[model samples]
Structure formats: structure tokens, C-alpha cells
Target chain A: SQQGEEDPQALSIQEGENATMNCSYKTSINNLQWYRQNSGRGLVHLILIRSNEREKHSGRLRVTLDTSKKSSSLLITASRAADTASYFCAKAGAGSYQLTFGKGTKLSVIP
Target chain B: GAGVSQSPSNKVTEKGKDVELRCDPISGHTALYWYRQSLGQGLEFLIYFQGNSAPDKSGLPSDRFSAERTGGSVSTLTIQRTQQEDSAVYLCASSAWLPSTDTQYFGPGTRLTVL
Candidate 1:
């Protein structure tokens, strides 16, 4: 089971501040992805970093992977109220069909 | 041009009753997945259907849970003799083909409450 464990079950930050979340997995993985869930219903994919890749950036979101430590981090720079949501880290391993997810870090961006 | 769609956004059933949740994946998407998310918990993989291949049921919690994909498009997840523990938000996602590392478009999810 390559289920990732997200750090800091919950976080609250002021607008314009940066929010960072970390995830650690148990075993080797093929890919690590981040998703944001809003209103507890739909989940939107944020980024995907393969094992071969080290870092990726999309808009204000940045993700770093350290396979040697089996950990990954997601950084949301200059967060806004609209960014308040639950963020999840999921992993896909070689020969694995499903993406195992972590419990997620709940973010609250205050205005 | 639409994303994944799920029917009966909310379902309430008595214990021991049967309920079927429907998922309509995006047009032309060949991979469909079903997952259950309990309150404050992560998404629990339920089943996966890709093309005409056999579904991977390794994540199903029990024999009472089953799913089927028809014509390689729509999917239905059926829970028989449902229990209180079955209460959760059932999410449906679909990708172009496989569930590996590709982005999966998710539906709004069907919230089920087993009384």
C-alpha cells in the first residue's frame, strides 16, 4: 500500500500568505499527484510529478518531490480566500491500477 | 463537452436495503473509477473499469459491493444489504484510458446515508 500521509491535518493562513503541505509515502512510487477538494464534493487536480521529475509548478502552485526521503511537498503561494479547501496527496506505483490518497490537509485562507 | 456526471446526488436507504449509484463518464473517456470517502477520510478505491477489460475489485470492502460498466461507458455501483458503515460520499472519476498517473475528472459525488 503506497498510501501517502499528508502532514498537518489542518491549516489556516491569511490571504497573500503562502501555504505549504507535505506528504510522505511508504514505498516507491511511479507518480505523485495533488488534488484540491472544494465544498466536500468535487476534487480538482492540481499537479502531477513523476518519480523521475523533481519539481513542478503551475501558476501559484509548486510541488517538490524527494524520492530518497519518500516525501513530497505542495506549496501555494499568495493564497486567497478562494484557495480554501482540502488538499490531498495521492500516489500511483508501478503495476498499480488505483491512486492511493492521503487523509488530506484542510486549508482555510482568511480574507 | 461536459464533465463526469452522477445521478441522485443524495440517497437515503434503510439498513439491509439495496442502492445503486450511477456514473456517466465524459464522452469518449474509456476509464471509469468508483471511490468511497467517509467523513474526514481519504478517498477509498472501490472499483475500476477500463475499456472491455475485467474490473479490478481488489479495493472492494466486501462481497456485498459490486459494480458494472455497460457498453464501456456508463457505470453503476450497487451496494446490497447496505449497512450504516456504507454511508459515505461515493465519487466517480474518469480518465482517457487508464487510472495510472493521468488526470481524472471527478463528478460531484453521490452522498449516501444508510439508516
Candidate 2:
């Protein structure tokens, strides 16, 4: 079974708008990572937020983790058409090296 | 450094035939993983290899699926008696360490279509 579930199965937005996706998990985790996948390709690692951290930033990507709530959110500011892709959240469970992934949210950024 | 790489970007095979998917992890990466992604679906964890330890095969869907990592670098996933339901993108990723404080780099993946 999957340990994480992402909300908003799909999102559509115009370029230059901000897009946010949320994910919730069922178990305690050491870290939560986000990835982006283009059509017919493998995933690319975007960012990772540790359980002790509340927020992190990398270029246009911002991620927040609320361990108390077992949830995390990814914010992509000033989206571009190139940003159109499926986003997934993977949680590294406590004491486990393997990551469990969520169903993912598909984001389409129209230019 | 070179990233993770998988062989045979696309494959089309008949049902009941066997197939072998290969993955070559980044040099010095100790953790390798296999995942399956169906159309319009998220990735499903298949197996994980950490260093020289036993692999975590808990996520394999059935007995037909099996994998082996040789020398802690290259891995292969073999499916016996392929089925149409098994058609999907098989992805491979590798991390430098366990617990993944470091990012896991992914390969282009192999698209398998079991006809």
C-alpha cells in the first residue's frame, strides 16, 4: 500500500502563476522528497525536506513540511510551460531506506 | 558524473514471453531502486538495494517479478511470462547513501508494452 496521498489530482494554470500541491502521509518519516516527471520519461528530483525542517527553497521551488500534521506542500512560483509535468511526493519512513510514493498531482502550465 | 541509466528505452513483447530490464547506477552509489509507473499513474516501488545487504523485495507484485543487483552497481529486473497488465514504464534510480538525505537520480526508464 502507498504511504502518502497527494491532494488535487490535477491542476491547470497559466504561465507566470503560482502552483501549489499538497501531500499527506500516514506514517512517520525521516524525510519527504518531491519529483517531477515529463511525459514518457523518468522522474527528476526537485527537493527534499527533512522531518526537522519546516520549509526549504531552491530557485523557484519552495517546499514545506509539517511533521505534526504529517503533510507537506510544494510551491512553484512563476510557473512556466516547461513546468507542466506530474509531481510526486516520496516519503522515507522512519528507520527505512526505501521510499513510499504518493499517487501524484499532474500540473499543466499553459503558456 | 554519469547518472543512472537503463537499457532498451522501449520494448514490445508478446504475452507469456520473458523480458529482462537492466539498470546501471551511478558510480559509487550504494542504494538502487526499481519502480513501475503505469499510464497516468504514480510510481510503484518494486525493490530496493542498499550496499551489499539483502534487497527489499516487499513491493514486488507477484512471483513472476524478480530482481538482482550485482556488485552493488548493476541491477536487472526479470519478469517471467509477461502479461498485458504488466505494460508500464520501468524506472531505475540510485542514491549515494541510505535514508536518502541525498537525492536519488533517475534514469530515462524503459517502456515495456506486453502485447
Worst-scoring 10-residue span by lDDT in model 1 chain A: A90-99
DockQ of 2: 0.71
Q: Write the per-residue lDDT of candidate 1 for residues A1-111, one digit (tens) a residue.
A: 437899999999999999999999998898898999987897898998999999999999999999999999999999999999999999988756688999999999999
- Per candidate, the number of residue pairs that clash is 0, 0
Candidate 2, clashing residue pairs? none
Interface RMSD of each: 1.3, 1.5
Per-residue lDDT over B1-115 for candidate 1, one digit per residue giving the tens place of the 0 to 100 score: 9999998899999999999999999999988999999999999999999899999898899999999999999999999999999999999999986545577889999999999
Error at B104, model 2, angstroms: 1.4
Cα lDDT tens digits for candidate 2, B6-82: 99899999999999999999999999999999988878889999998999999899999999998889999999999
| Estimated TM-score for each candidate | 0.97, 0.97
Off by over 4 Å in 2: none
Candidate 1 CAPRI assessment class: medium
What would you estimate as the lDDT of candidate 1?
0.93
Q: Which ten residues in a row have the lowest lDDT in candidate 2 chain A?
A: A93-102
